[model samples]
Target: MASLNSRVKGAVMGASMTGGWLLADLLLPEPWGDVVLYAAMAVVNVGIGWRLGKFYDKQSDKETAADFDAKKAANYELPS
Candidate 1:
């Protein structure tokens, strides 16, 4: 499994791959080829979105945890 940053990098690579395929298809004559390329591009885009959502969820969880910890500390008292 790759890190969040690596996953984003992979997504960027996927975009370039799709671009290359599109260009190649344009150079050659094949109507259905474009459809296949578009489908692949859509899948990559979905994956990228899912990965980004996961990254944001993780950050939110950390922030929530910190907020809870701070509140707990503020409520605590010590004997003199």
Candidate 2:
């Protein structure tokens, strides 16, 4: 089995997000029939997926979720 590359991961993530939203759009009642909003949502989702892939590229195999939690704790500390 081959490991997935970052670019593929990003593309897959972006496509999946867009596809999921489209599926929802088909099933749900159209409250907001704005095409621009839907387009913007797809762009934002793709951007997030791209960023996630970049983040994955920077990670080391030895890194743990606890390390991520610690980083988050430092960066997003609640106001004292």
Candidate 3:
């Protein structure tokens, strides 16, 4: 599992990269320019998707942990 700091850093990096690629695409000249930009966009999209997946996995793990804690608490019995 990644520490919270790593996850935050990854998300920030992904957002900035995606935004920069988009802005560059708008400013650059045509033909191969669009092609190159699209390629970069695709790469950034994949990175964003991967990052989102990681976040989902982390959320699931947290939910599972909370469920286990709840179960453990419910099953606690008084001493005989």
Candidate 4:
């Protein structure tokens, strides 16, 4: 599930960055357009990295909790 979410997030970011670059190229001129496009891409990539990090952290926490729960369950024993 986390993997799926990450893939979808990556796809969306890639598409948006491409679209933004195209739009900037059409609206701006020459060096300025290229500069803007690069800057936008850099910022978007940073944001994507940050988001993915958080998502992975959350997924890890869930997995850790599940493992702990399983260990506790295994250690339990009923009275005879």
Candidate 5:
């Protein structure tokens, strides 16, 4: 199966965070201060998700490169 793209992953994470905020607000409405706090938290959540995606992408690239190298080595034939 195809893996989720980095942007898609970040979007999913950010969207889920927004949904959680909505649900929490509905359950317990807060004052203006909390609203502002939540907004900041939402931005922070999105940023964290983006950074996580970037980190994962880097790790995946490294793993892929290592696997390719291993496969190439496995197929190497010494010259007679």
Candidate 6:
């Protein structure tokens, strides 16, 4: 479930970035426009990548912790 959500989030972010770049290119003028468009794309992509990276990292941590807990529970024994 977490994996699926992460993939969906990544896909949405990619699609939005592409759409935004295209729109910016169309609306803005010549060389300066291209420059701005690329810059904005870079910045946005970096920000989104950073944020999603953290989110996935946290999700992975949660999954690892859950797995560890399950294993610990399964192996638990009564002290004599």
Tens digit per residue, CA lDDT, model 4, 1-80 = 36578679878867887886788788988888888878887897798789989999999999999999999987895657
Best by lDDT: 6
RMSD of each: 4.5, 12.8, 5.0, 4.4, 6.1, 4.5
State the lDDT at 4 in candidate 5. Answer: 92
Listed per model in order, the count of residue pairs whose N, CA or C atoms clash below 3 Å is 0, 0, 0, 0, 0, 0
Residue 59 deviation, candidate 1, in Å?
0.5
lDDT per residue for candidate 5 within 1-80, as digits (tens), equals 14999789878977887897777666765687577767877788798889989999999999999999999997896767
Across residues 35-67, which tens digit of lDDT does each residue of candidate 3 receive?
A: 988897788689878998999999999999999
Full-model lDDT, candidate 4: 0.84
At residue 56, candidate 1 shows an lDDT of: 100
Model 2 C-alpha lDDT per residue in residues 1-80, reported as the tens digit of each score = 14999789878977887797777677666666446557768788698789878878667533776688789899998789
Error of 4 at 59 (Å): 0.5
Q: Which stretches of candidate 2 lie over 4 Å from their true place?
A: 32-80
Q: Evaluated with TM-score, which candidate comes out highest?
A: 4
Q: Estimate each model's TM-score.
A: 0.64, 0.40, 0.64, 0.72, 0.57, 0.70
Between candidates 1 and 2, the one scoring higher on TM-score is: 1
Q: Which lDDT value does model 1 have at 63? A: 100
Which ten residues in a row are the worst by lDDT in model 5?
24-33
lDDT of 2: 0.74
Q: Return the number of clashes found in candidate 1.
A: 0
